[model samples]
Target: MNINKEENHVQSVVRAAHILQLVANSDHPITINQLSEETNLNRTTVWRLLETLEFLHYVERDLPTKGYQLGYAPYRLFSKNNMYLSLIRKARPLLEKLRDEINETVLLSVPKHNGTLTIDQIDAPHSIRPINLVNRLLPSHCTSNGKLLLSRLSIEEFNLILDRELEPITRFTITDPTLLQEELNWVRDHGFSLSLREWDESENGMSVEITDNRNELIGFISLLGPYQRLSKDKMLTLAPKIKSTAKEIAEKLS
Candidate 1:
């Protein structure tokens, strides 16, 4: 048995994982020199490992800072983990309660890059409810949950998304950047957002922000239904209850 060769392979894997961890834990992009100093590996070895990790999208180079940050791979893995499952599990009862109270579809969504990813959903009792949006990445500018989540991003991050051509999902969708900016400003100030037949001509939704104990935005809870049943006035009237429900879910998760 070539024990030395096997040991070398294992050592390489361990060093790579250590480098990835350092990048993940950093508050800002981490330079290769910082990784090498922390890992006690030589610069060449660190660079080679980083090259492999970057190729696999486990780490990505922050071009502006010339440093490394976590790539898409970790987030994809995180989405499938027990922790993510635990979040859904802990919040399910409250979501169900909200749905029962309002008899409207309830959606749980989180920010996914420039969009919103619906993680879980509770369908409304009415047969005429909106279609299921679970496991879909919908445009942030067109959905209530998307807008509420986007409102929590830093100004630089928000601008990056805004710089993209905002696609219109429906005639009512906010394709005008200036108007969208105004809408998001209102959402940030009020801690909620509304989408009146924006994503779909037949459906309307209102969303409330969910935050952790530190008040950091984590996700959103949205109530959706047919436009006839969930008119703008009705949604505004129910806003307090929906916001309270979101707070309960956040507390449960925290």
Candidate 2:
């Protein structure tokens, strides 16, 4: 069979790459039918391309919804890639300095789903201190990272976060959505936030936004320790330093 000029260049690999690029560029999930229409390819061809991408873990599919989304592979790739690795390396010295100054566990969190989850953490020098887990979701209504991230959200977005079931992680957890919104507003006004034994019964923390030079919300930096040791006055004293250090790190990223 004689292949036409266009057919000769219709490489499956090229088409697959184009499909993945389209999905990555979208902020929401897309369907195979949508992709087929966009690519001007038949439904069978689009499905085959989607399957290949999914097998490589670069795309995800939801059978029930019949939609596709960018998979975790891209995030894993970014996390290990040179660009973010360099950013983390540059941020470490500042994190070390902040940890030493506060004499507590200093942490950095990035927005993930409804929470600002921990991505990096440095424990207190003392051996008896509580261990803060890295890569764990901190409750949005209770932790300093959560409030600061929530404060950055628009009113509608913030409302969506509040509508979810609130977990009372501790007696102090702000389970009331109205109250949580009020606290988030206060954090916005104050430029920093404090969580005194809210997420965990014994843990207290102070958090502030890490924003780029353009004032985009990148993440948050927080100082945390046992409530028994870090008093109210001590937390107040540490807040500005945390904010400043976060700003310094954000500048490097920008």
The numbered model that scores best in lDDT is 1
Question: Among these predicted structures, which one has the highest TM-score?
Answer: 1
lDDT of 2 by residue, 1-254 (tens): 11123465767766887788889776568898898878888999999888888888999987677789888888787786543366567788999988887688888777777677777788878765656556577667788888887787898887787677888988998888888888888887889998888987887888888788788877778888888887668888877788789889987887
Q: What is the lDDT of residue 29 in candidate 2?
A: 81
Q: How far off is residue 200 in model 2, in Å?
A: 0.5
Please estimate how well model 2 matches the true structure, expressed as its whole-model Cα lDDT: 0.79
| Residue 57 displacement (Å), model 1 | 34
Model 1, runs deviating above 4 Å = 1-83
Clashing pairs in 1: none
lDDT of each: 0.86, 0.79
RMSD of each: 14.3, 12.3
Count clashing residue pairs per candidate.
0, 0
